[model samples]
Target chain A: MWSRRTLRQREELIAYLLVSPWVIGFLAFILGPMLTSLGLSFTETDLFTLEFIGFENYTKLLSFDATRTLFWTTLYNTAYYVFLSIPLTISVGFFIAILLNQNISAQPTYRVVYYLPAVIPGIAASLLWLWLFQPEFGLINWALSLFGIEGPRWLFDRKTAKMALVIMSVWGAGSNMLIFLAGLQGIPTELYEAATIDGAGIWRRFRNITIPMISPTLFFVVVTQIIWSSQVFTNVYVMTEGKGGPANATMMMVLYLYRVAFREYRMGYASAYAWIFFLILLVFTLILFRSSKAWVYYETEIGGQRS
Target chain B: MSGAAIGVGTARTSVKRARRTQVFLIHTLLIAGGIIVMIPLAWMLSTSLKPPHQITKFPPIWIPDPFVWSNYVRAVTIFPVSFLVFVRNSMYMSLMITLGTVLSNAIVAFAFARLSFRGSRVLFFIVLSTMMLPQQVTMIPLFILFSRIGWINSYNPLIVPHFFANAYFVFLLRQFYTTIPRELDDAARIDGCGVIGLFLRILLPLSKPALGITAIFAFTWSWNEFLGPLIYLSRMETYPLAIALSFLRAAHGVLWSELMVVSFIAMLPPVLLFFVAQKHYIQGIVITGVKG
Candidate 1:
């Protein structure tokens, strides 16, 4: 028989062997590019030149004539989108999951209907939404006429364009709702029975039992949703043609970064923008993690404590 | 307990009626929401079938007068390149990604879950953290790297990355592998099974659910990937359905009729796969979040 030390060494070697591919890929593809982008952010780069300019790109983004306005506008648009979509998505998802969780007929059929959009490609879904939002001949306006409420030009009008994106986002809310439903199902039936024995109504049971049980999943959905919404690009790119237009109303940061990098070939400046956006997300995520202790519940532990 | 407190139970009758009405209202609201959610998709199908003039007609034709089967045929022909090429390329690349990711990630996940080693926890955490890094931050440098490697203008950038294993899939599979009984491994080891044998003979057979889930996710993600293929593959011959569809949109200049037909065709693979694996996909999404 092999010695314990030799067996342990063999196991370790196998572990390393198994994971070597990921390690190499991460170093060559992910780590190398990530560090290069960070370094590039501090430099001034153009089509013909690149130099270490020491915060020049940052300063330009903050105070330069045109860049500053673009930066702030993109930030505003992203912030507005993240704020509106996160709550709306979570609430809608949770409510739908609750209804689906009930002992209702055709539950499977309802689930498939809700989740159909979530499975479709983002580009296809965005294209479908674009047609739905057409101003003159769109079905939305047609439906509105029956109620005698004239719909505004959705994608054309600046005020309604962002709202239109938000509306489009709701179609795919089924993914998050599925998560919430799973979380809801995971809550023990005993807990509900106990709450009922204590004379708790449905609202009280939900408030005291269901919410705490699902808080961790809720936190996960919220954090990821915020991160995703802040980086929204594909829809805006396909729908608006990277214009951020109808007077720059829908110009998200990632869309702006695409225009900078690909369209204008301002690689270094775009790198800086990318890093700044990363920093904002990193900071916000850290804050969310810090605050999670207050809300997130660990089932294995009592007192609703964080793990 | 409340049964004893309600001696005047006619009030309870009215309250029960009120609760029933409230339940009815909630169901009504849910049905309305479902319809609103479905309207855009419904309209896409409707407009795609409408004739050219009826597409933009006033007060819009909600349903086509005669479903124009010809529009789909025209959409297939309108793009200069064959749609079949895009479909074949997309299927091949997506299948490669799915197979590569499942095999590589399952091996790594088996290691992480069943094996004991120093620094394993830290390394696993690092893998998880990588998922948080947005792809945009690395897109430029990755492009430069691929260009230098002569992997650009081909499917290498898209397919080869799967060999390394994605962080999300790795983490998911690890969780799944951990749930298998350790006694199985112990028993297999006593029968002279090496680590690889244990993995192949014992664990792999039992991990069908996770493998299925991973493959489905990999297929869907690869199929939907637009930005990666758009940047890397320059030649028209190398384009996927997503790139092909975008080109169709650009060529037609947002011709609603053509765009609708092309979009529906583009949506087919994922929609079909979703219906096939609906139960598993929904279960995967739910369980990942709830368990984590």
Candidate 2:
């Protein structure tokens, strides 16, 4: 029979062994590359060739190229997409959640219907949107014509491509809606009852009680939406073929990085671009987290503190 | 007092009338939103059925005059022999990834939730932090690593990484496992079950919903994954449905009918999975916010 100390040591070792797979994968697949990419940003080397010139890539990215236009435009598009989509999605989701939160008929069926688009694969959804936004034979235009309004050349026109993406983004607002619904349910029923007793109207009660109570969740959604929107490559890739086109209207940063890295085979330069994107996201997320304390209400003040 | 009571009654009656009106308005808005959401899907279905000329017809045909079931068959037959291979590859890889993710994540989560392991919290945080790193940063280096291991152009690269716990899934399962009382494990241990046996027998059985959620996520992600397969699998035979469908689009440009059929077929598995596993998916989301 082993001593208690020995047995404890053995258990620790076993535990370490069990988690080793994840630890190893994290180091190799995630950490190693993260560090390497950081280093590579300062160097000029084709990743395959490995002939490195120091500090050239970063200097070039910062000082030399007119590609700053691409960077800024992409940043503007991404910011616009996030800023527009998040509020719209959150509000729409919350509105729907509020309606569904009530005593409604066939609520589960309605929930499922709203949630369906969230489950559809991105590629399929983008492709479906492609057909829907087709200039001549598209159903969207057909519907527009019925209302006696001319439809814009959506995908083909630079003016409307980003708007089309924003519209597409709203289609999958169901996931956020579900989260808001859960948050709604978690708000204490007593609070609402007390508000009602104090002569609060529905809208007033919602503003004072519902909004503050669910602010944490709203913060969560906002942060995630910003992160995800900034990394918007797939929709742009599928819709615009990485051209960002009709004159680079929808050319997002991530899509541009993908093209430069894979298509143009400029790995080191793309690494710098990736780092810039990461810094931008990191700064924004930090700002949101810093500001969240002012607005986000917790059931227990100490209970909801998450790093 | 008499005047105040009478005024209150009128106000209450008007409020009731307003509530009824609001309910009607809400339902109307929801129905309209639902229709708007459904239109693109409807258009896809309609386009898939329409004849060649009708596909690009102005004012878009809402319904096809002649319903064509042959588009699906034509789509299948027109693609390269490798299309079938891609489908097979996708199925096998996705299944493996799901199984591996579920098992590994459950194990790691059990350790985190139940076992008094040293460095567990720190390790878990490390896992969480990894999620913040954009995947693009690691793409090339991981590609190099896999190439070095001779895992490139193979499903091993696609599926093997999943055998190690993913941060999100592990965090999810850990939360789920924590909710399962420690008493269950203690009772099993009192009955002379070993640690591994307690986990497998007691915890695993109770954590089916979590498992289902992880499995569904793994399956769907693997199914819809384009970048991984595109980067690693150069050979057509190793391509998955997403890559294969993209190829079909490129090769048969303007064959909208056939492309629609292919897209619909490609969409089937995830949609069916979502319908089947909707409960756990929603539950997974709710629990994470609480236990996260």
Candidate 3:
């Protein structure tokens, strides 16, 4: 049908055709919703009617009065979770990766055991942990008894709820371990050999050769974990029975936004909450990206091509 | 000379002994860590088989003395909506979404990777940047959009968005496509294979591992998704396994054994996938840094 058209034009047309679905979806799903959400933030609605509320929703959420809203509590709770979970999970994952990177027998079997928990569906894992964390009869407390230490009320106690979640998140650090392991394996063995010949001990070789080489991987894990963990909802929702409670101790921003939007049907208020949450995430990600240059080492830079 | 050689030999043997001890210590630590990691899962299995009497005991039973295999049956049939319905709903949605994800991502990625059209670079950058936008920002509007279109309680809302191609998968596939040599495309075109022909015959056929990775990621993502199903499907009958398993606790009063049985059932597909196609699964995960 396009025989008369030049080959280049035909190629361009075909390219557009191939990509149109994604472009259309991006506009319809992502861009359009983003704009509509922004518009919705300015108006109060309940799915039936809309009233222009201006910036009331934002101000209410960001207000100093913690009594009027649970926004601060949710933010604080989420921050607590994010800040604590990231470093712990990263360190644990990196440590495991270093262990697995050693030339050892039954390596694949060890890897499978570690990665198994990471693949369990979130809901199932949450359910499993809920049972495991039962204060009286749970295996955790039972094990604690064996060590002659009394176990604290985990998810049931507000003071320990966030800590319980941090512990659970660390269990699923197998993927991070795998990523770090890949990075570890990628380090040329010759570097370690040369260092050893120069009388560099294990710690010296690890610091000088290993750490710099995998700095990029470490940076990647941190960034992704930040973005992902900040939106943590399923585990908290399922375990806490969608309440984030034991005095709202585990109430994350997304869960709070969910309640406001779906439960209360406070569309405008929820949209505002959503936007605020988005900006906070954006700031964190931006800061991480900016800071990455100082730490994230790339071999390509020395090769004179910055990819 | 003999005395010096003997000294060197002694030093070498001592070094080897130290290395052996190091390996032994590493193995010991690995075993200890592995047991710690496996405990939760082992307990889940134990809990699923335990009788009601054994479940709430002070010291948790490591093994169920009277193993109640009937918990699985009770779990499935005791619910108002049978667990089978939830399984069917989950499988249908997961399969459809996986199909959509694989097909859409591969085609769009092909365009960006193989064709050097005007503005493709800019468009791909937009695709990548979208990854940073949190889902919560769009959640409300999307809920409104789907509700306005009368799509709630149906699989349409859960499955349709995947057909458009997600940015992360597109980026992954595009990366995969570029690693294939351009010479094949050139040779195909010289033989009068058009653009579509090249993609189908030359590219798609050879991109099995990449596509397999994409399919596995999509299937697992769909299988394990919680928030989407939670928001979209409100009715018990329409609920996927994730939603259904969560509700089991709320609806049934501490039916721990039954709940475990259902949770185990819900976890089976993805866990089995990981076991069966572990290399591809791990590769897919590592490639995109996507995790459960």
Candidate 4:
């Protein structure tokens, strides 16, 4: 005959058991490694040996020419990819979303058409693009010649490698387009009708009503896309064959960090690099959230102050 | 009055004409966009069937003259090991990850959604935080951990973390589970259902749609996952489709025909599965989009 106290305790125990998978995972995988990585960043550790080097890894990343160059170039490449792709993706995705959300016949078919490329595995897409980007006898160049416009050597050209990646990103923007479409559908028709009564053209309704209504989603897409695309790997790895050449022009931060850890075995240095990237991503994310206050419209100001 | 009637007729005619033009223009633009997006895929299928002689020709063969059905066979057999191993490995990984993620996430999500325990809010927020946490930092250390555990060159590294429940999926499921009314959970408890019984019978049975979404997303992610498999599964036998496909092009000079054929094959499952479950797929994307 258990007492009520023991029964309540049993319930609590069950609750803890229910959540333990995630809690244990958080401890074992996320929190544990995060702290370990942080600790290791300061200490240079070969597998068999460990020494507390005291900011040597961090200092070298900033001070050494080769390390700094690698770090900066990768960061720059990542920034370029993110900056170019996010706006292009959001804009084009928004445009396509609007088109599909209309009273068009066969909207799902068109959505599927646009979305098909997105579902294709990234590596497969990269390979297909690799063939298409072949300087001579490539489909893109061949198609370009038909229009009498000399095509730039896309992936092969250092000047255009990142651009090629941006172009690739634009093609796969359909997934985001679906998201924007979802946001668009969630907008009430009454609001639009009211806008129509208040004297608005198509472009005006879109710019003022649609854009503001979807701004929160826009913020979401922008932040997440920037975060994800900054870590773009498979494309770089597959297209450039893990070399990040010609002359490391396409080397992004993640790739560089991977090479550092696995290829060079600079575990401490790579951890340091990883933490820096993490902080940068975190800062960017925070900045986005802060700036979102200006542009992101909320229906009820969820989790924020009501004006 | 007659002139006014004639003006109205003209106005109506012009409006009809304008609307027709608008419809035509929308289709045209959509069709054009569709074609642009499909060119790579269309070109892939076309290239895969072309004879080797026509592959690199300046006047590229737009369509294969003799449809070489044998190219698919060649692609599978050309690799040092049977290409089937990679496909099998990838299929197993994707299936396991999907099941593990769906099952575990549903359990954890039930805990978060129903249990009003101390620190539940904080714990739920931690789950939310992990969804957006930068993985690069933990990647190396995790790799080290896995290697020390003798999981390197095996499927454990790729498959085990997912069994712990993906943070994104947990939040997604948690949102879904909350909609199933607290009354049901309470009634189940009164009916002698324990927490596990409540989850298995009341929650999960009703959460099939959410589970479906989780499964689909996890499958696609696991299938396309390049970097994880690339890092952990160094052995040729353990290589998944992504790594194996990457190696195919790198090894033996660029075999365009075989590469294209294999790529087309590699692409079939997700594309087909996507089409089959596209409604759920779209909902998954939308919910994730709105939620995030």
TM-score of each: 0.94, 0.93, 0.95, 0.94
lDDT of 4 at A1: 52
Q: DockQ score for model 1, please?
A: 0.38
Cα lDDT tens digits, model 4, A272-303, are 99999999999999998998888788878775
Cα-based lDDT for every prediction: 0.82, 0.79, 0.87, 0.84
- Clashes within 3 Å, all models in order: 0, 0, 0, 0
> Candidate 1: which pairs clash?
none
Q: Which candidate is the best by TM-score?
A: 3
Model 2, span A178-237: residue lDDT tens: 887777777777899999999999888888888888898898888777877678876778
- Is candidate 2 or 4 superior in lDDT? 4
Give the CAPRI class of candidate 1: acceptable
Candidates 1 and 2 compared: the better one by lDDT is 1
- Which tens-of-lDDT digit does each residue in B51-116 have in candidate 4? 888899886888898998898898899878889899999999999999889878888888888876
Q: Candidate 2, residues B1-292: lDDT per residue as tens digits?
A: 1111111112233447768787688788888888877777777888888888888888666789899888878888886674577679889989999999998898888888888787788888887766666687787667667887898789888888889888888888988888888888788978978777888899999998789888888898888887788778878777888877777766875788987888888888988988887766667667665211
| Per-candidate interface DockQ score | 0.38, 0.33, 0.42, 0.38
lDDT of 4 at A61: 85
**Which predicted model would earn the best DockQ?**
3
Error of 2 at B244 (Å): 1.6
The stretch of ten residues in a row with the least summed lDDT in candidate 1 chain B is B1-10
**Candidate 3 per-residue lDDT over residues B177-275, each given as its tens digit:** 888899999999889899999999999998999999888878988999999999989999999999888888788837889878988999899999988
- Report the number of backbone clashes for model 4: 0
TM-score of 1: 0.94
lDDT of 1 by residue, B212-249 (tens): 99999889989988888877887888899888877776
